[model samples]
Target: MMLTILAIDDSRTIREMLRETLRNAGFDVHVAVDGLDGLEKLHDIAPDVIITDINMPRLDGFGVIEAVRAGTSHAALPILVLTTESAPDLKERARKSGATGWIVKPFDDAKLVSAIKRIAAH
Candidate 1:
């Protein structure tokens, strides 16, 4: 099956990069500019997996994770967070909010794809 993936990031460049990379890898990709927009898209279509960024204008990555986990329909959905913040405290908070995995910024395409496939496999 072609897995549908939702990628949320405030930076248009990162969003497009992820979308293209995943698409070339044979996955269906959808994108949102920020957390709030990502939430709206999540409600409209529950993708197999969600990849998000930590810093955003509307709702940050943690906020998205909280909202997704709080919703009965999406509570169990898998989420991989890609962010620049590598602090242990931030990762802990993300875990507390129910993030599935974390990858620091400037990630290699291969690693990112591997992580996505791993999470989507679940």
Candidate 2:
């Protein structure tokens, strides 16, 4: 079965772009505008991996990672926190919250896809 990826970011353009790119890469894609929305989507369907941004309305990437780690259904799921922030402290916090890795924003599709492939074992 194809891996399903849940990508949460505030930018509609970024979410759409990621959905299209991941779909083309042979993975199922789901989108959310922010961390709250991501959690809602998670209730509907559990994704193999979650890619998210750190800054957003309602809730941020850290909150998403925290919620996921606390949730019994999603605690074991892989997460990739994609954001503009490069701070070591933020990355460390995300790691503590259960993020598998980090990626900078405005990232290339190849780099993003490569990250997903590695996470999904594609």
Candidate 3:
């Protein structure tokens, strides 16, 4: 089965890059402008994995993760945070919010794809 991905980022460049990269990697990629949009699209896409940015309008990555984990159906969905923030405390916070994985921005395409594959493997 083809894996579908939901990528949420406030940056147009990041969103476009994710769309191209994930699509080229043989995954169906759906994008949202921010955490709220991502949550809204969650039901529609029912994505296998989610890649999100930490700092955004409305809701942030942590909020998204918490929201997703709040529900039984999507509590275990794999969520990978892709952000420029590399602070240790932030990483710990993300983990606490139930993120499956984290990726620093300006990420290597191969590594990003690999992380997604690893998380989605379950």
Candidate 4:
């Protein structure tokens, strides 16, 4: 089965890039403008995995991770953080908040695809 993915990012450019990359890799891809939008879409789509950015207007990636982990239905869903920030502390914070994995921005298309497949497999 083709895996479904919800990709959240505040930047329109990033979202479009993600949509193109993941769709090219044979995944059903959905894009959300920010963390708030992502959470809303989460309920409607129930994607197999999520890719989100760290900084956003309404809500951030950390908030997205916490909200997803808080919900019983999506608590175990795989969440991958994709952002420009590569700070170790931020990564640790996301890890503690239940993110499945992390990817720095300007992400390698091949690696991003592989990471999603890896995390979703578990």
Candidate 5:
């Protein structure tokens, strides 16, 4: 089965990059402008995995992770934090919020794809 993913980010460029890269990797990719938009799309797509940025308007990645974990329907979905910030404290916070993994910004396409496959497999 083809894997489905929801990628949320405030940067239009990052969204586009994720869409293209994941699509090219043979995954069905959906995108949102930010956390609020991502939550909305979450219900619609029922994605296998989610990739989200840490900083954004209207809601951030931590908020997104917490919201997803709070929702009954998608509480177990794997969430990967994608951002420029690599602070250990920030990563710990994301983990506390229920994120499955973390990737620094300027991500490697192969590694990102591998991470998604790894998390989705579980």
Candidate 6:
């Protein structure tokens, strides 16, 4: 089965990059402008994995993770935080918020795909 991914970011370029990368890797990619939009799309898409930016308008990655974890249906879904922040505290906070993994921005396409595949396999 083709896995579906929901990628949320404020940057259009990042979203486009993720869409292209994931699509080329044979995954269905859906995108949202921010965390609020991500939450909305979450219900509609029921994606196998989610990639979200840490800093954004409306809501942020932590908020998105919290919201997803609050719900029963998608609570167990793999959520990867894609951000420029590489601070250990930030990563810890993301983990506390229920994120499955972390990827610093300017990510390697191959590593991203591998991470997604690994998470989806679980």
lDDT of 2 by residue, 13-74 (tens): 88988989889988899999999999999978789899999999999999999999998977
Each model's lDDT comes to 0.92, 0.90, 0.95, 0.97, 0.97, 0.97
**lDDT (0-100) at residue 100 of candidate 1?**
97
lDDT of candidate model 3 versus the reference: 0.95
lDDT at position 38, candidate 5: 95
TM-score of model 6 vs. true structure:
0.99
lDDT of 3 at 29: 96
Task: Return the clash pairs for model 5, or none.
Answer: none
Superior candidate under lDDT, 2 versus 3: 3
Please, what is the TM-score per model? 0.96, 0.93, 0.98, 0.99, 0.99, 0.99
For 1-122, candidate 5 gives per-residue lDDT tens digits of 99999999999999999999999999999999999999999998999999999999999999999999998999999999999999999999999999999999899999999999999999
Q: Give one clash count per candidate, in the order shown.
A: 0, 0, 0, 0, 0, 0
TM-score quality measure for candidate 4: 0.99
lDDT per residue for candidate 4 within 1-122, as digits (tens), equals: 89999999999999999999999999999999999999999999999999999999999999999999999999999999999999999999999999999999899999999999999999
**Where does candidate 6 stray beyond 4 Å?**
none
Q: Which 10-residue span in candidate 6 carries the lowest summed lDDT?
A: 113-122
Stretches > 4 Å off in candidate 5? none
Error of 2 at 107 (Å): 1.2
TM-score of 1: 0.96
